[model samples]
Target chain A: MDTLRLASHGLSKHDQEILSKQLKMLRGRTACEWVLVDDYRSADVTLVQGQPPSDMPGIIALASTKAGKSGRYHLIEWPIRLFGLIDLLMAIELEWPARAATPLPTLSLAHRLARIRQDQWLDVAGMVAQAFQAKDEFRTTVSSFDELIERLASIDGASVRFVEGHHPLADQEAALEPYSLKAVIWSLALREEAIKSRQWHISQQQFGIATWPLFGTWETAPWMLRLAALYGRQPATLADGVELTGLRVELVAAFLHACELCELGLTVKQSTRPPRIESKLPAPESLLARLRRKLGLGYKRT
Target chain B: MISKILFIGPMGAGKTTAITAVSDSEPITTEADNLDRAQSDKATTTVALDYGEIYLDEDSSVLLYGMPGQDRFDFMWPILAEGALGAVLLLDHSHPDAVAQLDHFLEAFAALVSCGALVVGVGRVQNSQDIGVYQAHLKAKGLALPVYATDVRHKQNVLLLIETLIANAELNEILER
Candidate 1:
């Protein structure tokens, strides 16, 4: 069977190895067999760590920011997972036949947005609103609370209100008031009482998902980011999260607490029992034995 | 008396390097060509364990054992950890899942960790924030283990981890008595 050729750009040796291994695992599962090629020109797809070359064909951009998107140029966020990458490649392959002609625009919106100074909020908001309206998916990519509110306000016939003490425009329409994304995230975490009283309410799901703005953002702490990513994929208890994400039970509980405050986490029944740690005894002549002998103790292997 | 100290972490966290750095004599390493290159970029990895030793005085010495960092060899962890005086949990701050790796090793060596016999040495930290993340993680667990930004390639840093683990073991003994 003919295989799909893939070439990598700017990825570390480790990342390339991971991609290769994941691709090999994906061979029998999917009809498309992905093979890594050193030559970019002959490859069917080019996976890049940062920006892809202008001349590159069938680009798969790996980055944290939502800078480039097209029918052909797909973006997978950094800290790439094996499953996520495979899903993206399969999507691109499926869409290739239909999107072959238009090929997505190469403009780096993330790069352009990053250059906007703090003082350029209004101007940047206008540009962001335009981009968001032009591409519905852009609504999910808003970086800040201000940008999110701005994008929401630009939508015709949308009603947005901030609850009591949550925003400066408490109990007032969001169209009339300005709020930062940081304040919103902070209020959601710290001011649970206010949030429970309906601190903020939007009439419509502007970004498809109810909490799309909160999915991947700088405001999310590292542990929270890991937890959110894992839970966002599926419903899991705190213990499940600890086991899955390799975070401590206490740390996972803290994240769960924050998610509960924000009403972001789903309530699932958790196992009451602590995770069991299996113990295996080392060989008698191993280092453990040597240490026990030196300490004037007999080996008591467990 | 010889006290055993175990070094544990994920792949590429520098267990072998840390052991080699402080060993008084040549370190004994059991390395093989890494078949799971996807887990690490290194051409070779410790399949069994890396062993080294250092003398504290004429009568007492410390045996350092570095466990294979991959999950597949996790069965060797409890074995190596048996009769251990304490542990040095090395972390590669540059790894994509550094925080998760920290939690995994901590859970794997919970016996040593709960007794305050674990010292975390985080290597390749980009900034102080990386150290802070680890510190916060331990703090959240109610653990007061000493955490230091270290480079296992350097003898001084490796010694710091060893000394910290030894100190914790001594302190635990005193408190228990």
Candidate 2:
């Protein structure tokens, strides 16, 4: 009969492991019970041991009060804390716009949250990769997450609504209202900082695996949110300058391809040549006489 | 309005001569003038790119950009190929690597295919037998793209190649619908 106060931010991997060990050792005693809650203020769990002094028959004698002074109690003989952590993650994900509307209380919340975070990270990296590959579009690629977020907010049909009440995020949301038009600007700036510190190529690979066949796999509802996360990475060039040697052909080809994709026109400058002069002789006499006289003169084909 | 046309081909494919024959103005030589110009330290083969122009109309000019024959200069290809309305891929009948080079370029620029860019094969075939081989090789790759056999030096033959490009573009525009 020990009580522990846990924060809502919830378990790390080590914390889940510790709870599993505690659950198995305290089983088969009406003494064995646990509590679950959305927050500390909401619930508590209570387990009273040595009620009837027996493992099975005596275990049935203890009275359990989950609602009063129990601190959100629960009972388990297996490692279920991991599952709880997963549920927490799922809740966060579901609450966030990126995940679907349904809140995830059944699935392991931690796993889902980790997966979602990883996916967004990779997405940012992948967009950067695409920017470099499609150099023609690099000029317009959004590098910072803040910029990306702002861009999303400015998206043609985007709309934002405020839900009032004593909500956890209410203050944060209210504070952000003045900068709504500047939207995600701070987030984008933070994302840019994150990208500068990351290994972009490796990040790109991770991103590719995270979001395979990105063209059509994404849902329309989460499209803006996902894009906002992806644009988190700031713009960075993979190849600063290619060697002028052996890569000339490839470089030239790439340059030309970029120009073509960007619709750039070539500037052609034509050179003018000097005019030529013809040496002249005496004039012809008459129609017949002129021909005869011109023919008679020592004239060579010019 | 200037319409750029790129001439792409394998080594010794008469790309240079073709430009000389069709150009309205004196061709600006980009081919290497000195041995040192080539990084290879060999005097044998080195050239940057070839440039020429053909007038489509009094207002519209079609610039002919000739890519160097060697695979070594393939770097400059995309730069030269930019904004090209169509490409004339010249293949030397005698060259053993002609088919491979053709495959390389087509695969490399797959995006261009979707953009309605015309790729016309200009083969130097001495007889009908050679033409059959060229057509067969192209068909084997599932490329039913337009292919022509003509002497690059002949003015009328080059004109035919240009017409083939225009026709191919029109056909694609219709097919897209």
lDDT of each: 0.55, 0.38
Off by over 4 Å in 1: A1-302, B56-59
Q: In model 2 chain B, where is the ten-residue run with the lowest total lDDT? A: B37-46
Q: Write the per-residue lDDT of candidate 2 for residues A154-273, one digit (tens) a residue.
A: 332112222223434333332221211111222222223222222223111211011101111111112221111121111112221111111222332233222211111111111232
Per-candidate iRMSD: 17.2, 27.6
For candidate 1, write residues B96-171 as lDDT tens digits: 8888988888889888876766777888875444566776676566554556678888876776565444434433
How displaced is residue B77 in candidate 1, in Å?
1.2
B33-123 in candidate 2: lDDT tens per residue? 4454322232333276678876544665668788776666777777766767677777776666667766777865555544435444455
Model 1, residue A115: displacement in angstroms? 31
Instruction: Report the number of the highest-DockQ candidate.
Output: 1
